[model samples]
Target: MLMPIAALLLTYLVTLALAGLAAFVLRRPLWVLLSELCGTEERSSFWTVWSMVMMIALPLLFVSWARVETDPTELLQGTVAATLTGILMAMGGMGLAVWLRVPRADSL
Candidate 1:
């Protein structure tokens, strides 16, 4: 019913928030990785943080999707779908970070 839907949305939001926190913590490492991968000297701190956040949030989103399902089959499907969605989102975020010219600031 609506309860399951609400629960799923809530879980997604919670996961997103957690990812944001993770991104904040792992921004530097993410930036370094991205910089090396792209073979660019330019640094986009904001994008790195955002991408890392998305990556961290992805697994939580899959867990939430699985939790909201009633049937085991549906849950499995949801988990797979959620995982793919998370991967796409993370990749998109990383691509955006690399394409955007956001300035990098010194980390504390």
Candidate 2:
């Protein structure tokens, strides 16, 4: 039981690092997108930070839910691809959330 939790924790930390790096690389794009969506400067900053956190959390959430066994080797194999895929998945989620929350042009 402890080992499973430990493995998950390790996966979470490593993925967080990867996600942080990805966010750092893509910060400008994220900032622009968040700024467009937010009505105020304060909210833009809030959303910018929140989106980065979401990007980091998403992969860990998926892996935790899907894994039946916590094998670190399996997790680390092809880590680069996994990290990129994770970033994309997180960005997709951010898009979906914003789309759902935003007012439609048709409504205005």
Candidate 3:
């Protein structure tokens, strides 16, 4: 029981880290698109910081999750928890970026 829960948490953490890396790599493109669409000289430094945080957080989550046995019921619960945690972490990273007033650069 406890092992399953731990596994779920670990998976969630790993997913978060992977997602953050993806975001970091795509940050430049994302910022360019947003700037062009919005026609604002705003910058988004949140991607890099968030990516770093996720890189650390996700692996931990996954390792913890993997400690449990692979049962159907446990798997389902773990998936849901991991998904929600990732989403929340992403949002929080965005929020932090906004709060920090990171400078926006023109990608053109």
**Candidate number of the best lDDT:** 2
User: What would the TM-score be for candidate 3 when compared with the true structure?
Assistant: 0.40
Listed in order, each prediction's TM-score against the native is 0.43, 0.62, 0.40
lDDT of 1 by residue, 1-108 (tens): 345666566556655665555556667777786776556655445556556656877667566546676454564466556765676677676668555644457532
Question: Which sections of candidate 3 miss by over 4 Å?
Answer: 1-30, 33-67, 102-108
> For residues 17-84, could you state the per-residue lDDT of candidate 2 as single tens digits?
88888778777786776687787778888888888887877766665555534565675653445656
Estimate the overall C-alpha local distance difference test score of candidate 3. Answer: 0.55
Winner on TM-score (1 vs 2): 2
What RMSD does each model have against the real structure? 8.9, 4.6, 7.9
Candidate 2 error regions (>4 Å): 1-6, 37-39, 68-72, 78-85, 96-108
When summed lDDT is taken over every stretch of 10 residues in candidate 3, the lowest stretch is 42-51
Which of 1 and 3 is the better model by TM-score?
Answer: 1
Ranking by lDDT: 2, 1, 3
